[model samples]
Target: MGASQAGGLPVSLKLPGIVLGVGLGGFVDGILLHQLLQWHHMLTGTDSDNIGVKYYSPYTVPGLEMNTVWDGIFHTVCWLAVLCGLALLYGRLAHNRRRAWTSRVLWGWILVGWGLFNLVEGVIDHHLLAIHHVRGGPYRLWWDLGFLLLGALLVAGGHLLQRSGEPLRPRDADDEGGLR
Candidate 1:
């Protein structure tokens, strides 16, 4: 009840919100690392400097068609976790409060997502094509891994705070103590 959602949106809509959050997070990662930072292309099959592929963004809409199987998979997982959280928080079968083990497990999965993001990004961008290093160093790959680890920690911290009684609603500002 404390969760401050819009007046008309149903609880079922939380799943889509979770999916969108995860997917948009991926989009930001791709844009920042691949486009801004110039780390790697969407698909690592070809070199970034390749004439044919360089100018063409494979993951974009028309000029370059692509597959987002991996992104979809991760988003699906995030949606499931978010659904579970919603269920535990509001569903008939669940208690009003989240269970301890459930929160811990969710935190663990967050770590998994972070690791997966790092592995896929690292293998494709750093190791395979040797584009830009993670942070421009001899062991830039390790640096990138460390960043992933930090993100995992942040997710875990966020979940822990949520479990401590913070609301899950997106629209609320002050009442929401941690990450959205």
Candidate 2:
């Protein structure tokens, strides 16, 4: 709830948190699975991968280069997400910036955002579009399912944590006695 929102309430950290989380989660997947482990690339998925032939995108140097370029584009989008999140966060803070940074509500929303990214990405990229996968093999379906499961868990956990948080406020805003 926020003043600009439909009802009268202070702004929550949900938007920024989710944006940051989605960006962070993308970074993790790109760095760990795509670059470091060489599990897959932007356009690596093909029917050949399903049969374990390991087509490697187009199976040539040019294809690898193209995949690399696509990966760069993906990274750029993720970077933009992070920037957008920061801007939203700055707008939300009144005089409790420090406390908001450490608030459970913010972090919880971030977790939810990350989970949402995983769910949406996994569903669209891995299953619907067939562009790529967590990995290529007979067990690819299992890996994809596991990714979705992890996303669900994060969402559930984040929701639970967010339920316990209060709205942000300036120091002593709610306390009549500032200090003892």
Candidate 3:
């Protein structure tokens, strides 16, 4: 038997996929929204009456700097997640690593991971903690809701697509999906 069994297959790409997806998703959020677009920062939404979060206005230079630092920290965590996911996936593949790289199952799970990231982050940061938003101001609520909606769609889409993915059969693979 294989280490990762799913319906008599050794395809266990779920964990690493989700982890990698989360990291990549965070990169998208940090780069596009935080850096390029300048929509919001880590502490932009702290102005809300959240229980214990300190507010940091992006308007002031010091506040911006603080948010930037915290953003860097967030990016670091995301980077580690990507690294960890890569390590996990790499370690799991014993044979036919090439196919695993291009597997639709992997991609599908990655999308699901990204969606999960968006959903979790949006819920905790945007709605719950009020740390930051997808886009802040009058339409911030709409943007946040859209983010969650997008997450849901990605998860659903990924699930359906992944269901169609077949397990890879390596030339030298044994029962465990590894080199014999």
CA RMSD per model (angstroms): 10.8, 4.6, 3.3
Cα lDDT for residue 9, candidate 3: 49
Model 3 residue 179 CA deviation in Å: 9.3
User: Which ten-residue region of model 3 has the weakest summed lDDT?
Assistant: 171-180
lDDT of 2 by residue, 38-131 (tens): 8888778955433343344546898898888888998999999999998899877655467777778888998898899899999988988777
The TM-score leader among the candidates is 3
**Global lDDT of each model?**
0.44, 0.79, 0.84
Considering TM-score, where higher is better, how would the candidates rank from best to worst? 3, 2, 1
TM-score of 2: 0.83
Residue pairs with clashing backbones, model 2 = none
Judge candidate 1 at residue 94 and give its lDDT: 18
* Ranked candidates, highest lDDT first: 3, 2, 1
In model 1, the worst 10-residue window by lDDT is 92-101
Judge candidate 2 against the unseen true structure and give its global Cα lDDT, from 0 to 1.
0.79
Kindly indicate the candidate among 1 and 2 with the higher lDDT. Answer: 2
lDDT of 3 by residue, 1-180 (tens): 353432334557889988999999999999999999999999988888366778888999999999999999999989999999999888777566777877888888888999999999999999888888889779999999999999999899888777778755433424544431
